[model samples]
Target: MLTELWNQGVRNLVEGRIVLGPGLNVFVGGNGSGKTSLLESCHVLGLGRSFRTHRLARVACSGRTEFAVAGEVQDPHHGRSRVAVEWAGQRRSRLNGQWIDGHWEIVRRLPLVAVHAGSFELLTGPPEERRRLLDWGAFYVDSGFAGEWQTWRRAHEQRNAALREQDGKLAARFETVAAAAGTRLTGMRERFTQRLAGFLCDASTAGLREGLPAQIEVSFRPGWPEAESLLEAYARSRPSDLERGFGQSGPQKADLDIRVAGRPIREASRGEQKRVLNALVVSQGLVQVASGPQGLTPLLLLDDAVAEMDETGLGGIMEAVVSLGWQCLATTVDRGWAQRTAGARPDARMFHVKQGLVTSLD
Candidate 1:
């Protein structure tokens, strides 16, 4: 589990670190005291990106151009691990310790899920983003995923550049590249959806089951599957894509049409969308433990995650954390939920935040 996280030069604060244990860790405080900032630091360190904004510089504290995060993990069952992230003088990132090479390498070694307000990006962002999320998790669960994805991505980039250059000859040369990548991406995604579906479980059994027992289905929508082969689709869509100024019909843009109880989640009520996202997250944790060698105690970062979820949704999430023996760090505007969560949890730590600092209220 994450033993501790140290952060500096982040929003609204000078520096801070909080020691953590295996269950629930709650950050409670007024709006601007950096309660959420601490969580953002964890989100940034773990995922290499912040859900709140695409820009890292935006989260930097006033007068500070750099930031750092340190985390310690102990695996009594296997071993221990420690890592730190430091970024100075720019919007870019800096790692202070031995680092993993690529973005996927970092995430695979450190698989952390951050579910904050931007969680809905799953429902709303480009299909490539959603697909990558699953692929990342798949890589975490299976090491071979990265090499497959990388090989395909390289080919796709070359082909896309060729298309942009309006060099049909070059694009044709890379058709095999697009087809291979598209097929693998599609297969990986299909298997993940099926696996998550089979794990169909309710968070309520652990006393957190709420909302409609979330129904989730993942379907592939190859933009032009019926009209052409992967290469043909690229050729067919190339002219219009260049006109649109973006590649519009590739695996890079492929999407999985998600639905909750037959309702298109994007068009569903706010409450429904939140529940579906929650279910996916919880499902993600369950899959991790049940499938990997690392058996990483699923780390769930809930930044303002509950406020938008219903009582059932919140309870369900908490229940899943406890049931799966996963670790959770959540933030809230009020303590009512925290208090209730504490009461329900036998092993949970609570932290009070004020202006970028965190104090454990045990």
Candidate 2:
């Protein structure tokens, strides 16, 4: 659980230290009051990137060249530890006062799952978004998956560079390495997706939707023809990849196919799609908590999660959050609505944010 958070020089938030609760923590405020910034800070601390932007420099306040976010987290295995991330022209992260190499180290200490307006893309957006969801689960469930994924990404980049240079010999060598790493990456993702399917099915059956269709199905597309191996697919696509100036057939192109009653998710109504997306996000956290190694439960961040939902939908989502027994930080513009949705949980707490200031309301 996150016990405290401190931010400086981040967007509208110049300075603040928030005491967080163990369960549902809601931040209520009007738009542009830095509620989302707060959540982004947590994301930066855990993932080393802002969910709000691709460039970390964009998060720095105007006239400032640096930003920092730190948190006090208690892991069942690690006990209480201080995790800090600082960004100047570059990023530096430390865990328990010792310098760390990358974001995955922070992730292992503080596993996080986030859902926001953009998260709808998981359903209606490109395959990359769904692939990220799959990879996040795989990263947490299997410790070695991250290294394998990194290897695949590096090889994929080298292969692309070789293709762009029109170096057939170099491309072939990198392609072999890429295919080997991608095959392992694909297997890990496939296994994680299969495990998550059961949790998603259970969530749907347990009233993820009321009048809306609950028949949701999920499948993995390993980014290549199923009848052929990665090496075979790479060979088949070599000519096209050379012409296109990039490698095309590998785990880099993987996707998660979500369907509702035989119809693609894109064809579903916005409300139906949101429910399905919510189920996917929440079930992901459920899988992390239930299947992760001992003493590891993901922290969930929901940015304006209840904006479009009715009372029933809100209740169902909140129920799932409560049932998973994990910590969740949610943002809202309406305090009453936030309270009403999270009030039933004994550990739920509320805060009010105005123009970048946060005050406890619990």
Candidate 3:
């Protein structure tokens, strides 16, 4: 869990630091008052990227050329370790004031799960979003999953290039590598999905006030025929691959099917969808805490979470977050929500933001 957070020139947030509580930390202010920016800073420190924007430079405040976010994590065995991200023309990360190779070092120590306004995209958006979420879990639980994922991606790219050149021999070679790695990737994802389903149901039962349907089922689509091995599937799809100048099927096209009751989550009501997304976030955190490496607790970032829900639903989500006993940084425009959440946990902390200034409210 994060013990202290500091940021400079990030979005509209004033250069400042906040001592974070291990349980719940809520930032409250009106829209455009920098509430979300504070949460984004925590996201940056944890993930080395912005949940609101793709370009890191955009996180800089108006007319600023760069931004930096740093934080201290409470390591049970090591005491406290510092992680920082600084971006000007290029990105750099530091661990304990020493330069690190990449953000993965920080990610490994401070994995985070975010549920925001765009979280609904998990259901309404394309397959990549869902796939990304799935891989995040697999990356933490299955040690070999990341290396194999990169290997498969490289082989898949090579196979596509070979097919584009109409080189059957080269394509076949890369296909063998891709198939081997892809098959393993599929297995890991399948197992992670199975675990996610159980956690999702648990989170819904505990987090959603309105409650989910009688049955919640989560399934994985491996992006290929279930009957054929990946190698065989590659051979079967070779014709279409050559015609299109790209591989026709692979794990890159994988998706998740989240069914509430008997129907897809897309068919659910707005309030139901928001609650479901919150539950999914909680479930992902639970999966990580249960299976991740020792002493590494994933942080939860909620930006105006459960926006479509009433007070009852929001309180339910808050209750679930507090119960997790992990670090949570949440934002809200509603003061009531902040107060209620702060009251739920004796260790909870609250901060108010206005015009880029942050003031802690004990």
State which candidate has the highest TM-score. Answer: 2
lDDT of each: 0.69, 0.85, 0.83
Ranked candidates, highest TM-score first: 2, 3, 1
Residue 26 lDDT (model 1) = 86
Q: For candidate 3, lDDT tens digit of each residue in 302-324?
A: 88864778777777777777666
- Reference-based lDDT, residue 109, model 1: 42
Off by over 4 Å in 2: 203-205
User: How does model 3 score by TM-score?
Assistant: 0.93
Clashing pairs in 3: none
Model 2 weakest 10-residue run by lDDT: 203-212
Off by more than 4 A, model 3: 77-79
How many collisions per candidate? 5, 0, 0
Tell me the tens digit of each residue's lDDT in model 1 across 260-327.
67777787777777777777777666666666655566678888756777777776777677777778
Find the candidate with the highest lDDT and give its number. Answer: 2
TM-score against native, each model: 0.87, 0.96, 0.93
Error of 1 at 151 (Å): 2.1
- The alpha-carbon lDDT assigned to residue 326 of candidate 2 equals 78
